[model samples]
Target: MNQYLNHLHVLRLLVQRELSSRYKGTIIGILWLFLQPLIMVIVYSFVFSVIMKVRIPGMDSSYHFALYLMAAMMPFFAFQEALISASNSLFANSSLLHKSTLPAILLPLVPMLATVITETIALVIIVIAAYLLLDQVSYYLLLLPFLVLIRLCLSLALGYVLAIMSVFVQDLRQALGLILTVILFITPIFYPVDMIPTELIPVNNLNPLYHLLDAYRAIIIRAELPGIGLLYMAGFSILLLCASVYFFQKTIERAKEFI
Candidate 1:
């Protein structure tokens, strides 16, 4: 019991350090966390809504599209950032791992926790924007914490798997960026899911991210409850997390040698 508490304390400190180091030399510091996503949201909203004139079926105006995009983007940004940072966690912390008795799992966790904190702030901004811009507030928004938990589980599971694999296959770090880009374009982020062709619906269902973002949109944009599929996805993510933890533990010793 004491050991678990000690690890939690260590994890908290590591997360603080990870977050501070990310913006240490910058002028605006942690404000970049909010600004970066906000800027992207603004740019994408303009390009798609103003120039391209994209519109959703039920949503009346371009502002609704912007709000929809913001809802999806915050979680996706957090997921992408967490995965990328956690993937490199082992390599980045190699010296600390060798010098200290800290659990290697904590390395990936540092970045995951930091990303969560950063994106939670971003989500708060989105909520306020939704309330102010759209004159909308949903009781379903309360479910966001549950969805975020599922996202964290998914990110941490993949992080553990990738961090261990990256030690053996150094090229994975470079390839991951391209892979995530492909994932972003493929997932219905900028576009609505209804725009997807009927024949491709089954294939799209295979992507876990689609379900996640769908749930986010349902709550944020439509003020509706997501379907039972979200529960199933949550269960799958938990199972995958358990498997990843087992894999990470089994390979961590060999991974350290490579590190």
Candidate 2:
């Protein structure tokens, strides 16, 4: 128990360092945390919900699409942001890598936890707005914590691969940016899955984010439990996590050489 508590303290410092460094300089450092996402919420909500006027079948209120968009955006943002940050975590902290005997596995976690903390705050604001405007909240809202855990594991798995690869191939950093862009457009972020043609459903099924978003939407927008299919995806994430940890440990020793 004491050991676990000590790790928690270390984790806290890591997360704090990440936030501070990212926001270094400028007049409004930490406030940007609240302001930036809030600004994104307003801008995206305006562009899509107002100008583009997108709609989903299950949504009833005029703001329903915005609410749905925000709900889905919450997890996806964390997933993408955390994965990118985790991918760069090792290289970004190269100095720290040489410092001590701390577990390298813990490095990627800093960004994940930092982003989760920031997004959780944004999510609360959005959800409260959702409840106020729509007058409804899902019992599945209770499943949010579990969904977060799944997202963390999924990002961590991917992060392990990207972080190691990045040390060897500098181009990977830029390549990852383009890849994440393609992923964003491919995933049904701004649109509904049903909008896709029937023939493409098979292609859509191949995206892991597709299933994660579906399960997330079940609770966030529909107030329904995720289908049993979530179990399969959860299992997939577990396997990926185990494989990633092993790969990271094996290749990590050589990472410093490339860096």
Candidate that scores best on lDDT: 1
Q: How well is each residue in 1-259 modelled by candidate 2, as lDDT tens digits? A: 8877888899899899888988899689988878876777677677767787776776665577887788777778888898789778888888778795667878887898887787777777676766776786877788877877877888888988888988888788778878987888888877898888999999988888888887877776677899776777788898999999999999998897876
lDDT of 1 by residue, 211-258 (tens): 998899888778899978788889989999999999999999988888
Worst 10 residues of 2 by lDDT: 54-63
Clash pairs, candidate 1, are none
What TM-score does prediction 2 earn? 0.91
Off by over 4 Å in 1: 44-47, 50-52
Q: Which candidate number maximizes TM-score?
A: 1
Candidate 1 overall Cα lDDT vs. reference?
0.87
Q: Cα RMSD (Å) between model 1 and the true structure?
A: 1.5
